[model samples]
Target: MATIFKTDAGNYKALVRKSGWPTTTKTFRTSRDAKDWARRIEDEMVRGVYIQRSGAERMTLEMALKRYLTEISPTKKPTTQRAEATKAQQLISHLGKYSMAALSAELIASYRDKRLASVTSRGKTTSNNTVRLELALLSHLFTVAIQEWGLGLSFNPVLNIRKPSAGQGRDRRLSAEEERCLLKAVNDHSNPMLGWIVRIALETGMRSSEITSLRRHQVDMKKRVARLSDTKNDSARTVPLSKWATETFEAALNNPIRPIDCDLVFFGEPGKDGKRRAYNFNKTWGVLKKKLGMADLRFHDLRHEAVSRLVEGGLSDQEVSAISGHKSMQMLKRYTHLRAEDLVGKLDMLTREH
Candidate 1:
């Protein structure tokens, strides 16, 4: 309900009231002007029309971000937390100062354009991949903000914004000789543990993250299986531990670092806080690859080698899929390459049998 009042002091004024929102009042120079503006605004409200909200409000971008940050504190996965936090920081930098209701279709389009125009990591224009990643994070956050939090049910403007294409999956792989060379090099290195990491990568087609997060209790020598939970897809899986893998576990049991707590099988060097932490040897790996003139091969290529070898060993697609814990044949197919030599070998074997 609203009321129009005329003041003898020489000003015409009006008052507006709405449920769940504060009342607003304005003063106008003439009674005619006040009536016209009041009627127009009231009529729009009666018709359920949206008026763009501005200023620091409950649904402002900054408030939503603070809510998001406060909610993710219970998680302990450092890598996952770091990545998500970095993404949130990017969103705050991009849209934190704006009112949630004011993010219209046209303005979102403009923001997308500005983000895609140039990538400035350290104030210099960089690659398209950087922009693509940041935009993906933006879209994901807005999706959560609108759909999950119900910040503005009627006003999700991100859908109209076009997304840039994310490129193909990585295809870097190691041939048989290269795998042999890598194994030999790792074995001869000053770090004895490097060889174990390399061997485990070849034995289990697990990602580097999964391998690094391995715990002693996860390994079962009796059943010859390793239990892994919280993998890439957040799915739990049990994979076989080969004879050599079992022996590796036995070797680890002999060396105990700081009375093992919980299920941690492997721990990194102590941090400044004096707590043993799990570390990634990516830099050392990079240096080793560079020395061998095989720096082009990525750590993930080790998983590819494991898959390729399983195929070469005459394991059926299903057999390899079970060990690799791949949910779909599509993901498995990317690592499987057709070898002309394999076909030639089959032909030669046929001739010999005949």
Candidate 2:
């Protein structure tokens, strides 16, 4: 049974008390509304499908995102943590005022459409992949709220919405003349670390984060292997160093000006907090590329160039993935863009052998 009575403030209040269930109360502007709400609650209770939505109604998206950043983001990798924090800000700015209960699939779909239509700070339209990743973060937060945080959400709104397509992978390969100019410019820069980092990427096909976050002890010159324990995929791998790569490592290791307190292979200047972090050469790299007339060439393309070279050198697909730390053959194939000029040499050799 339920009680619907007029309140002292000229509003109607509905109260429901049932056996084997917690008491629930809600204030409504009209007596009819109060009775209607009470009847729904009673019907749901009888059907054994009642769920208290008070918590979801009170908790806003802003509050949930902050909690997630504090409790969940720290458990991810440093790169992932940073990326999630940025994505959280974007979500918070747009949909933070909406309570969890108020966020419907239609509302989330509107956000998706708006984000796809908006331009980024970089003066380009936001990519579909960027929107997809943002939605993915939102979806995960809702899942965590339901399963772990006990927020009592009936279903994830984000799951009900369509995600943007994952755009095509970049097939940007460096040309020979461009590579020569890039190397010369980096080698001649005031900061020698920039040159060594570029050479290492070209030689070992290591990710920028992997190459920059290296410690001296991780590299073994005698074994000619650079051991990576904190990789992007959370799988440890040992990258075999080429003769050229070994020489570059030796030079960087034996740098006379290197601070004794810094253990990072590529150490930057001390920060305001007096911490010597990894070398941040993004600004420098950007300037160098612009000067060399290769403004479109990205640093990751260097890794692609190296992987393609490995494949062209007669290394098997498995062999290339092992070196590049790629988890799947499909992903490895995306990076291996073989040049037509290189294939012509193979064709000529086949004719001679026959």
Candidate 3:
């Protein structure tokens, strides 16, 4: 039932009371408007489609993102948590003042466009993947708010919005010439560990983080296997070492310059506090890339190169996925691209057999 009253301020106030639902009240200039609002609200309640959006209307996107970071981000892996926190900060800077109730698909689309057009300090436009990741974070935030936090959002605005295409996954594999150039550059660098790291990544398909964070105890020289206790997927797996990788590890273990404080296989000299930290090769890698004229090459591409080699070696997808630590076969396929020239040999072999 709805009750309409003439308030002292000469406004018509309408109130709708239902047994199972919260009471909804609104003020309008005319009784017709008040009645219409009451009728629409009651009808929605009866159809079980009405969501109480008071909390969403009260809380801004900034507050919700902050709360999510504190409550949920810690549960994720450290690398993932850092990236999510950075995205959350970007969203807060753009849409922070907007209430959850005020966020619409139009607004989210507009934000997407804005981010796509924005350039970084390096003068490069933000990649489509970056925009897509931002939307994913925003979508998850709405989901948590609606399902767990009870923020009263009816739907995720990001769901209704179109996301920028992530574009094709990078299929950039190093040429033999490029590999020779890179190896020479790295070997001539000041740090001896840089060449070793590059070799391990190319041979074992290990991520840079995994190689850098490897502990001495995790290496089994007898078995020629390295045990990874903490991986990106949060699952433990063993990576077989190549003959070269095993030899490098053996030499590194026997190196007199190895740090004693840190258990990490690749660590820097002790600071004033006498604590050794994981070696950071960002500056060194950059300088080497410039020197080799391979500025576009990324360290992660080594993993791609390794996976592609495994695929070209006639390994099944399942076998390659095990070495690459890819949880999904689809993801493993993305990294296992074979060059057209390499495939030519297989095609010729098939023709000869025929």
Best by lDDT: 2
lDDT of 2 at 95: 95
Question: What are the per-residue Cα lDDT tens digits for candidate 3 across 244-282?
Answer: 989988876776787556688889767799788778898
Give the candidate number with the greatest TM-score.
2
TM-score of each: 0.75, 0.94, 0.90
In candidate 3, which residue pairs get closer than 3 Å at backbone N, Cα or C atoms, i.e. clash? Answer: none
lDDT of 1 by residue, 1-354 (tens): 677898888898977776644565667888888878677767767777735232223476666666666664234366656666666676677777877766666776776677667557668654456556656655665677756765544655677777666556566767778878888998897665677777888887878888778887787889988888868767788888788877776675555443656345555777798776555688889999998899688888888878877888899999898888787998888877656677798899999999
Worst 10 residues of 1 by lDDT: 50-59
| Ordering by TM-score | 2, 3, 1
1-354 per-residue lDDT for model 2 (tens digits): 899999899999999999988899999999999999999999999999998877788899999999999999999987899999999998989999999989999989999999999999999998999899999999999999898887778999998888997777888988778888888999999999999999999999999999999999999999999999989999999999999999999999998889988899999999999999999999999988988888999999999999999999999999999999999999998889999988998899999999
Off by over 4 Å in 1: 3-15, 18-63, 72-77, 109-133, 147-150, 256-263, 311-321, 334-354
Ten consecutive residues with minimal summed lDDT in candidate 2?
166-175
lDDT of 2: 0.93
Winner on TM-score between 1 and 3 is 3
